[model samples]
Target: MKLPYAEIEFDDTGERVHPGQVKDAASVISREKATDVIVICHGWNNTAAQARDLYTRVVESMHMVQGEVPGAASRRMVVIGVLWPSIQWADDVDSGAGAGVADEQETLQDMIRARIDDASVADRLVELVPRLEASSTAQEQFVALLRKTLPASTEGEDEAAFEMLATGDVGEVLSAAKGGTDAPDALAAAGGAAGIDPMGVAPLDDGGGAGFFDSIMGAGRNLLNLTTYYTMKERAGAVGRNGVAKALEALHDAAPDARLHLVGHSFGGRAVTAAALATSAKVSSLSLLQAAYSHFGMADDWDGTGKDGAFEKVPSRIDGPIIVTFTRNDKAVGVAYPIASRLARQIGAGLGDQQDPYGGIGRNGALKTAASLPAGTLLDVGGAYAFEAGRVSSLNGDAFISGHSDITGRQVAYAVLTAVATGRS
Candidate 1:
């Protein structure tokens, strides 16, 4: 994700990557042109180093799998890291004005603004990018930019910047600045669908399920959904699951074979599922990690085994499969059932440990809606964060990877990719 050496801009204080900066990164990603684009949305309260570590771990595994190693094939996934300035609140940090969190953020922002102040610094940054794979480099630059701009950006400002980047405007700006807008601009110009509202705040009940996010994780669930909606609309402006539906007619014309692969953690898994269904079956695969499929109603009803009325209509939409990953020890699911109970007012169903009649849960403890997926189709993961732990959340509670936030766990990434690529029941 590193921008072209000539495309990056810098200043005396720091180098700031506005919307235009992402085009270079996107070009790098699109150049890889993998069948499955593993879109990663980091959990809340993650440090720059933490995000890097997590990203590398998965990427390395992907590379290994590509080499016929025990890991997943990175080539199969076009890595897209959604870098938003949404603060992942760690309970350990004080939230008051002048706390260490605020101070550190301010410091980070200063470092960036300062780095961009030097003359030729922007030009020199061009060295950071080459005509090659750069997801890691781009992310580091993005992290640096985040640190530098955190102070200047509000929640909305940060989100707007991310929207710009995701929708291809950032790359357009950068490509135009570089005096060459062929690749970046062309990619940016690719039209797509838009309009997808995030699942607003709702109470979460820790009902001791197998695949939902626990209450302890930070607010990553809603943050992802909100950002996702805005990005989709900005990118395509057509064809979404709900709220907004503006399809990217140009996408159909540009990358005819290209399809979307969505992997959601915890409740975000639920969001991914709903979002995917909204598409015209253009999605290749869906991986739900410990997600809570709340469309059926509330917590009490989850264990009741009642039929998921509206949800039942989803599986038939896309030709792809659905994979749900969860674990018996995960406390995240414990939180989801109660939440479903309170809201839907119906008794929840089972923890999905044994079997959810729906379909698609891997032996790794994931729930699957499709036993076998299309050749290019991905799995739809549901329940809580089945394989991992508390990592991301929203205003109500934590969700992404219901069990734990350490997506870098030994077999977690393996299990996820294996289930998706293989589509084993």
Candidate 2:
């Protein structure tokens, strides 16, 4: 089915806009004389079709909400779906199904060693090492190559010590390479030393060490996933800052007085905030639905630097209320987010403790932020929740939202409409 809203597709870099589409989208808003423009962004690992389906659900839900709220339909609305290439890895492959041979029962250490010695992975590394040696500024060149080779969603600075490997320090590089082979054992030993489970969970013995090996292999696979996850986070920030932000600036120039409302799902939350920070676009309302960004993104002061949180200064840019939703049912943010953040920190991503806390905005509301107005009010679905201007309202999404991808429910649509209507009023 066709979406009820206009759609604008952006390339992977978030810079190039599809020709004729923006003008057509602008025409729709102009024709309707739309007072409010709602832009929706999707999260990671979604195909274009999936994004469109999500937009469809959101539009339908908004229609339902408008039916219940009198005078809601009187406001001319123009909905736009921001389609950016934010996918990292395919869903099926990311499920850890074919990572290790099912029949081969190996310990966690053995599994790490196997991945380290993986012929395909090693071959790529071997090819990369020579290229590093052949180039000047070998470290930077190598990192650039890795940024190209790695399946991260965003491009970012290399903070990890992998650059040290290319500084004519063959011994250090070889030692680091060798350390990869010994990582599992070292990690397990450290865990044992700390009086923790070496297998990362309860000791499992399903005969022949099958269960133990499976657990170890799972952890190893998670490392790979962490790489992609961090990449996606950086990419989301880039797309928002560079691509979406620029686009919004241009749109505002064309329609200076137009009211803007941004709704981001998962990583899109980071993107929308980045867009706001990157531009002087005056936003009316910002809604983050199960955002997969740092919970401290809206903090007043983070890590003594005052500029640590991704959206710390977003309030200054927005002219109205900022609404955020949180739920414990989002497994991606609840379970995988902290693990990925911890691994990214270990690799020198320079992710601060506050910005890279154990929980996400999706699972927990904005935390450590003294500036939150009303301190994150929890709203009931279909209930009257008028958002106060220049404040943040954190709503509990457990009643209507179930998981990371369930933001298109009727209740959520109602809540979004409430925010929009309240901001416009």
Candidate 3:
């Protein structure tokens, strides 16, 4: 195939290759040095497309950083593009159950989040997924990997199964949708506030709790969790359990030097936490894109904790650094209101935070990233890739600034990728 995108390199004497082709070529990539392992996880109702197995952003981001720090890519590092079954979160919930044509740029951002441990440091993390005693299917392989790769001990509630989906009862949504209600409406009735308009059934009213948009931002913060596709939806006895067990068994037997780096987008972000809290998998870190705890169902707050609840159990178990990338102007965030409303709310909540990081998508369809950073820190990790974005695009053809997703978006991807690539957190 003809190679496009000059920035991407492929020694295709054997075959002209592109980034897409390089991403999934695990064997080819594995042959390279094992310096840093970066695994990317995708968001809800979606699966990481390991097809052809090439990570384009990994290459692009690496090159971008190398320009500043030199030798960023050549460093002993293994770029492992981890493809997990995610629920596939998207901006247009109008698409039937996340079965939508995805924007590559948005998807790529989510992938970036999963590769870093930022999501794992979520208020809480779930237990490692269980492995089945039989069947080494791709899903099962991952479960086994977690079982063997994580630490020997942990603490948390193992609310396994695609608990959230089951909670809403996919049957109910399908039944109502089949009965003629629009899919969004059906989903609202099942999982959101009464009269949700955007996603259909729930208005997601922020209530008097905070500025409607800002108070609801907690939802935006966790919106990425929706991107994960349902898998090991099986709990202890469910299909996911056995698959996890089998995978863990194999991992337990692997060479001790073997390490696992989890990157989950959207719902997958929560799953990664689950596996981490459950197994003795020797993991370097976790990255969450569009992250939210799966087991933590629809609730009154972002904390998503409850006494005797699985999520409550989860937070108490995993302790690590976590990074989250969210946009105040995210359409899905429903943040059309003024930022002042949110600012006041933050003050009311006693967060002691004072920054307007998300500049609304302006008239020309340009989105600005106005985030707050630690003193002397740019890019939230490495000042190399981060820029004070003002809705500008490197592409002139279609203005490919990027699309929306739980983890991936032009700005969000840059934030997460720069953080991880530079080993910030």
Better of 1 and 3 by TM-score: 1
Tens digits of per-residue lDDT for model 2 on 27-144?
Answer: 7777778777888888874578878888888888787677665446677788888887765331222223333444222322332233232355434433444333234354344333
Give the residue spans of candidate 3 off by over 4 A: 1-30, 45-55, 66-74, 83-91, 94-259, 292-320, 328-425
Question: Which sections of candidate 2 miss by over 4 Å?
Answer: 1-4, 88-214, 304-307, 340-356, 374-380
Cα-based lDDT for every prediction: 0.32, 0.58, 0.30
| Superior candidate under TM-score, 2 versus 3 | 2
What is the alpha-carbon lDDT of model 1 when measured against the actual structure? Answer: 0.32
The C-alpha TM-scores of every prediction are 0.42, 0.72, 0.41
> What is the lDDT ranking, best to worst?
2, 1, 3
lDDT tens digits, residues 1-425, model 3? 11111111212011213434333333333454244444453333332343112245534544444434523334444444333333233353221222212332233234335521335422111111111112224223322322232223322322222222223333332222221122244233432323223322223333432211111122222222221222222211121122222232233343233333445444344445455555554444444443433222211232334323233232222222233333322333222111111221211111101121111111111111112122121132233443222111111111222223423333334444444444322
Candidate 1 vs candidate 2: the lDDT winner is 2
What lDDT, from 0 to 1, does candidate 3 have? 0.30
Task: Kindly give the number of clashing pairs for every candidate.
Answer: 124, 2, 91
RMSD per prediction, one decimal? Answer: 18.8, 7.7, 16.3
Cα lDDT tens digits for candidate 1, 75-114: 3455544332222321111112222333433432332233
